[model samples]
Target chain A: MLAGGHGNSNPNTNYLKSRGLWVAYSIGMLVLHLILLSIPPLSIPMAWTLTNQVHNAITFIVLHILKGVPWIPTDQGATSLLTHWEQIDEGRQFTKTRKFLTASPVLLFFLTCFYTVYEPHHFVANFLSVCLVTLPKLPLFHKVRLFGINKY
Target chain B: MDILEPMYTLVFTELVPSFHVHLQVLLGLLVLWVLFKKSEKPGRPGKAGKSELDIINDWKPEPLVTPVPAKHRGLNAPVTKNQIAQHITVNGVKCLNFATNNYLALVNQQEIDDVAVAAIRKYGVGSCGPRGFFGTVDVHLELEEKLAQFMRTEAAVVYSYGFSTIASAIPAYAKRGDICFVDEAVNFSIQQGLVASRSHIKYFKHNDMMHLEQLLSEQAVLDRKNPKKAAKTRKFLIVEGLYNKTGEMCPLPEIVDLKNRHKVRLFIDESISFGTLGDTGRGITEYYNIPIEEIDLVMSSMEGSLGSIGGFCVGTTFVVEHQVLSGLGYCFSASLPPLLTVGATAALNLMDGNPDLVKELNEKCDQLHRLLHKSETLARYFRISGCRLSPVKHLFPLELKSGTENELQKIVDLCLQDGVALAVPAFQLNDVKFQTPSIRLTVNSKLEAQDMSKCLSTLEKTVIATFKPTSTS
Candidate 1:
């Protein structure tokens, strides 16, 4: 029920590990950036920064903060203790989805850096957001909760 | 100090007030309406309706299921290409099946088949409707009567599917707001019942009486706190007579004592134990020498030891009668085919007429247990877990690894090649999954005594070959 359980959360979502997921994720990120860009007040750099922050915030909550599932989890409480990150790839380290999730945030960070430049504010915010999301995804933090937070 | 005071006044008066532009507009509109158009009706023309429509459009329904990844369970899984096998023969292989719960070796009986075929020809293939409707065939009544007589109960209700019998019966009596203390390791069917009942389910640690007692005492405290509401909440203690998951027997005598002390009605799912336990094959009560009348309700699937399809629940006339009209599986779902009911009766009769069949099964269980426990090499890698003289047994891997199932599958496949079908998950699992695996072994009375030893030696050799113990000191 904890870190040691299997299946890809659902049979229909078997595409989570498919190669097209990377494409879909990139497209979603691009669409998010474009939507932010459409805001009249936001500059190109600000839009990229906002996109990075929004992406990281969502991934942080979904992949790490929310333990267990929110819907009718057919597998009973088998995933009661696992976050979506831990649930994916059945808790095996260095799997495809884990690598993609870790890499996506860093990629967004670099993309934001390229657009925002080293202006202290945007650079720092994007860097921090990427770090918040990507750090927990490192193999070092597989099941670790540093200050006894959310262990249950 | 002067500059800060002025800044605070400026921000509060100017900046904060400007943030509420919509509020200002609404207030101005209200004043204008009050002054210039006092008699106008107050309902907004279209704004609220438009926003409501936007909100309705924005609402997204959640996916029907959230895939919570569950793992492989180690049961006596008869391996085919992948699907679970039937009791008679697994995946077209005529092997000594020590996988399914064919305890009395009644599955292969000619008499049962003869009765089943004759009845099938007479009644045709299906009952064609739910039991409550026109599906109550004459054989259905006969089988129910036979089951009641066999169990020494006042009456019984037969369900179309064995899995749903208890699943449906449980919800019939134990509805929302009821309290049920359940064993955590009871099979999926009982778990389904617990979930469907929407009851306050307190799961005691599997087969731990102290844990159950602690839960009961906690409930007592609650009941003491709210005696009025407590009186309305029915409390049930549910346990399996023989747990199919662990191949272990419940401490029935202790459970009975606890239930009595806690003022809880007891429900036992004897799916795996009904025909295998007692000398006379009357299940856990008979085996423990407890009177059948002492138990409030009894649920069992005939799929296992009865060597037939469907399931039954037996108790006093009052308890059993309630299920006939209210049990979801019995009332709404189609009844068991007449032929299956007929065949089950024949199988039960065979068990009733010859008690030796059950006695032999008990002996086989003991033999298997003793062999596994005493096997020096087998002991290191796997510790046997299950009740002695209970036909269901488990070999839990001492050091569970990622490849544990594969290793066990290899042993099972090897055994199958040697004409003994041992059950393990030759499970074709995806790349990302983990679960503790064990080898489940079932003992049948039909297995040859010499073949038992031969199977044991084969298991040892295969296990020894499959797993090269690293720390072989």
Candidate 2:
């Protein structure tokens, strides 16, 4: 009975794990974008190093940690955890809408920062004030299913 | 400082810090991953077989077949031609059968028809399975027994078709380490067998004995080290008895004598020569009076001249038995239908009965060759004589001027339009095409003397019309 049940469970777990890896990669990119925006202006080069270059360097180690940490919720059943994690279509739509709405504001913020550095203008100050006001309306990104710290 | 040290320092300084970090870390990880993967799946006991993933990666979809030109569109489309006696009616008008391989005029012969009908009645329609199981009919066994007697060998085996006999026989003998020495101009069927068997193979120049000797010498050295692994190694000399392209006999007596002296076994594919050479048409072995006993193996397609649909091989009992046991083409495939065997059996009997018919065929070939040689239009392209046509029967080569086979085909097509059947592009192969001097006009016993004359006259006219001398501008 143990052998038969284990045989049945093995393929399902393997398939779920493979798909989970893709999700983790996408979430990692999102986290990198968020951290870049949150960083100080003068440290932009340092932030670039931390996000893209540093992340790339330690990605293998992170992936190993992600795979080892079991994602299934201890309190909830395995089915509930699988269902939450497998909601890819819903997550993609949310990400798409969030990106479209935030695009102009993100672009304006970067442009204003650059111009302030190159050619100082009141337009840069005005843009920063407008960005701060609009921050309240920014859609909150909620992690629906947390596997582990490295994966989340 | 060393010159190499300065170069290395310059390369190291130029690389970006991020790139250097990524390269060192990622390269190590990638190497480790590959090593882990290799360790998990140790390769095959022998060499690694081609994987499905490899096949998929290498897959190249075939390019589409080119569409026919608007003018030539009807060439590929089927036409329901009303075939008549001595004339093929196409588009409701009478034309000749230039593409037909009805050499002996045996297709509709009363004697042949009667024999075929009787055999079909006696032995149902088909044996319906392979010879190993229920496919072997009494007639099939009898045919093989008779073929062995005819070819004058110890034993014989019949195959469902001409190509399968060739495709089966070569591989049945050749294994992993065997080296097959083949003629460059060999039929595609033999080539397929050699390739599918995965044996080491080499090619000699077309009809070049010296080139063959050189290849054999090269093989002898390779064989010495491995000794070709007794189970895997055999050196086979494969060539045709009568080259279907030239319609000329192989220098078999010479080939056989040379191969024997060099300790290599020879297998002669006498598809074209059988039923058209020798006193009784046993084939090239007898045509040259080289004892069949001296030749290692003989294979024949009973299609072109024999008016049948299958192939047969004659050799020692051991070889014949071995082929029956392991020849995948024979073992996996269904056996030849009994009706075709009936027809072949009839053809063999008829060939045995009619000695004079063979003599008449020789005479007809002689007459046709002489007439074609005399024709001013054909004389330039066709270099043939009486001896080449046949000593005992009608078969000769039409050696064309280089790259004129298509032009010869056009003339043949014109002959067809004028109600005379002609054979022009007889054998087509890679880098080689055989254009007969005149169409292979067989003077079968069935055709009246008048009919023969009319055919010759029509041929002469077609030649004249097709190749009118290019006037000097």
Top candidate when judged by lDDT against the true structure: 1
User: Highest TM-score among the candidates is held by which one?
Assistant: 1
Q: Report RMSD (Å) for each prediction in the order shown.
A: 20.0, 21.2
TM-scores (chain A) of the candidates: 0.86, 0.28
> Which lDDT tens digits does candidate 2 get at residues B195-303?
7666778888778888888888776676676542432456788898766544555677668877886677798897767766776777777778888877777887887
Q: Which ten residues in a row have the lowest lDDT in candidate 2 chain B?
A: B389-398
lDDT per residue for candidate 1 within B114-167, as digits (tens), equals 999999789998999998789999998998899999999999989988999989
Candidate 2 Cα misplacement greater than 4 A, ranges? A1-152, B1-99, B118-124, B221-232, B382-387, B390-406, B424-453, B469-473
| Shift of residue B428 alpha carbon in model 1, Å | 14
Off by over 4 Å in 1: A1-152, B1-94, B425-436, B469-473
Score candidate 2 by DockQ.
0.01
Report lDDT per candidate.
0.77, 0.58
> What does the lDDT read for residue B201 in candidate 2?
80
